[model samples]
Target: MWSTKQLADLAGTTTKAIRYYHRAQLLDEPERGHNGYKQYRAQHLLQLLRIRRLTELGLSPASAASALENDNSSELYEALTAAERELTAAIDKFNAMREDVRGALAGRSFGDLALQLSDKPPGLSEKDFAVLLVMSRLFDAETVLTFQEILHSSPRTPVDEAFDALSPNADRKEREAVAEMLAEQTRTRTPENPPYSTRGQGLAEAVEIMEKSIAHLYNDAQIEAIRRSWELLRAQKTASDT
Candidate 1:
């Protein structure tokens, strides 16, 4: 028979741990003797040693206790299997977060011109980055990759700068001129009309979200100019096809 302190020291744990185990119903408390000191038996020492061994094996305190309580070997195996699955899921989540951080550090670039005209283009504002973030959620990785390539090969001209500088309150004549210029540029730059791929739905959704974001970031006149430019470009394409 040994005292609580002696059992704790022999088991390589503290007295506080023994008391916690008692409260957790993991350890059986010994009865008080005539001198008012609790007497711990060999069984108590063995249980404490078992708990320390289980903890060394990476079993949580609760799992260790529950595994010890199971008399059947199969039940213990089940508990350990569940712990393994939880660890794997945690590892996967961490890996995904690490990849996202690496991407941020690498610089997802855009330009002052249209998104299609810049892979690592300069003059991207914080608002433009915000739109890309939204777009990233709506589109898949492949579509965005292709879009970036298209932008990288695009030619930069003075007209692109004019559209970028266009004010929200631009007059009708100014809007029309910008839109017509943009349409002509689109026609000259992208002469080949490839069939839109099925993957385009994701890009379309992302573009819609980006347009909404642009509405909040740019003034009404700028937004109108952009809308009119796309419309005129589509009409020009239709006319050429006929």
Candidate 2:
């Protein structure tokens, strides 16, 4: 017979851990001595050691308990296999994060987003980056990469500068002209079969998120210009199909 402290020492664990196992019912309650102090036996120490070994192998306490209750080796194997998969996924996530950090240290723009693009385009404002980040989340990785390619290849023209510099109080004619130019730019630059399809189940929700992001990120004039440009593009597509 051994005291709690003595049993903990022999098992290479702490008294607190032994108490926790008692609470969890992983270890059976030992007999009490004449002084009303708990007395543990060799069986209790061996059980504690077994639990420690299973936990060190990444098994949860419940899983360790189940493994101990069952005599089947397959059950223990399955638990270890699951733990291995979880560890691998964690390792991959950390490795990707480290690469992103390395890219940031090398003076690349946009952190995780920058990693997906082949080259960073000049003149992208903070608002533009914010919108692009929102889009990246709304769409899939391949779609974002394709969009980044288009952005990199399309040089910003004087019309783009005009739209960017447009005032909130700009007249309707000025806004329309900018919209026309933008619509034409989109028509020419955008692939006939774009990577992002509107047929998905989440399309409405995704569009709502994009609209909200645009509303939050851009000025009133810029938002109006974007809306007008989209309308113009839709009209052109409709006319071409007719």
Q: List per-prediction Cα lDDT, in the order shown.
A: 0.59, 0.67
What are the per-residue Cα lDDT tens digits for candidate 1 across 52-124?
A: 6455434578887887787544654565455444444565554543333233223442221123222324554
Question: Per-residue lDDT tens digits of candidate 2, residues 61-168?
Answer: 999899878855678667756665555456655454444333433455343334232223565554554455456556755666566667766777888799889888
Q: Which ten residues in a row have the lowest lDDT in candidate 2?
A: 111-120
Whole-structure CA lDDT of model 1? 0.59
Query: Alpha carbon lDDT of residue 183, candidate 2?
Result: 86
Residue pairs in collision within model 2: none
Give model 2's TM-score versus the native structure.
0.48
